[model samples]
Each structure stands twice: as C-alpha cells, then as structure tokens.
Target: MFKYAWICKNPDLKGMARRAILQAMDTKPYSTWLEIDLGAIKNNIKQLKAMTGTRLMAVIKANAYGHGVLTVAKAAEQAGASWLGVARMEEALNLRAAGIKSEVMVLGYTSPVM
Candidate 1:
C-alpha cells in the first residue's frame, strides 16, 4: 500500500487539500455530501462473519475512505465490529463527533502541535 506519510506529517495541508478537492469538483456542495448506508455495512459485516467466523475490524480512516467515518463506524459496531481503525486524529475526531462509542485506533502519529 502507498502510505500517505507526508499527509500524516501535515494536517493543515490535508485539510486544505480536502477543501480544495471539494471546491474544484464541478458539482454542487450538496451533491458532494455522501449518505452512507449503515444497514448495508452491517449486512456486509454479518455476511463476512458468516463466511469467515473471525474477528472483524472496521477501517474508518479518510472519512471512512470517503464513505463517512462515523456513519460506517456506527454500522460496523452494530454489526459486531471488534475494532475500529483510522489513519488520522481528524478522522477519529469525526467518529467522536458523531457520538460513536467505540474503540477508535489512530493508525499514525500526530505531532504535539496538533
């Protein structure tokens, strides 16, 4: 996997990039908002459990990789997720903002300046 270590080192830049990407898109801001289907995520987790019968963790970094982190984290929890992983503090904060009560692990480091 191509790790975004550079992004990890600079959160302000990451935020700017996110805003820029959103602004650059030739679509309405409302259209950029994504509605994640928690039920679908739960169903998929159930299916995976039935097939594998192993522990499952939800990777919810990068706004759930653009699927909305908190939404997906909630679904993953409802579907019996044993762990939740994120790539940055902001992503974890997003989950927290959504009132998701789950163990969120930040996969990378955050400078003290953060």
Candidate 2:
C-alpha cells in the first residue's frame, strides 16, 4: 500500500489532483493500491518542459509504470505534454478510447498480420 498527499504549488491544480486521488481510493477500498500524486506528475512535466525548452513526449507504457495510464496521461497532457508513448498498439488504442487526443507512438514491434 502507498499513500501520498497533493503538494503542488498551484492551489487549483492541487485541489483537483487531491480529489482525483481520493476518488480512486474511495472506489477501490480493501485492495492493494499505489497512491500516485498526480499533482507531482504534472509539476514534473512542467519543470521538464521548462528545462528542455521543447515539447515533451510522456512515456506512459505499462499503465504508466503501474501508476494508471489513463490518469497519468491526462495529467501529463494537461501539463503540456505534446505526445504519449506506449509499448503496444493496444495501449495506444486504450488511450484513444479514453478520449486522449495527444499524439501517440507505439514503441514496440507489431506483427504484420495484425
């Protein structure tokens, strides 16, 4: 089990992120869980963008390293990610199905027959 609190400097963003985490916990009680601070993810993306002075491609493969792909992807996009990277076409499709409009790239090999 993991627990965390929203510590973003932006008050509005902090509130939204905190609510999202709390909602997730509420929906999945009594199960092993990892509490991801979405606010931290957003802040890190923003910082990286500032440091690089270029657009960023957020790699959200493997359920965002087990942090919930959809949630992390949305937060990254909101924080100015220009693209999303995944390991498979199915992951990309799942993102699209969830209404993620960010440009996506499948980094893994695909069978020609598919």
Identify the candidate with maximal lDDT.
2
For each candidate, what is the lDDT? 0.78, 0.93
Give the least accurate 10-residue stretch of model 1, judged by summed lDDT: 1-10
RMSD of 1: 10.4
Q: Write the per-residue lDDT of candidate 1 for residues 1-114, one digit (tens) a residue.
A: 222323546889888876666667646556355566788889998898889999877887877787766667878999998778998888778777878887888899988998
TM-score of each: 0.58, 0.69
Error of 1 at 3 (Å): 28
Model 2 agreement with the true structure over 1-114: per-residue lDDT tens digits? 458866678999988987787787775556686789999999999999999999999999999998889999999999999999999999999999999999999999988987
| Model 2 RMSD vs true structure | 16.6
Best prediction by TM-score: 2
- TM-score, candidate 2, is 0.69
Minimal lDDT window, size 10, model 2: 25-34
True lDDT of residue 19, candidate 2: 78
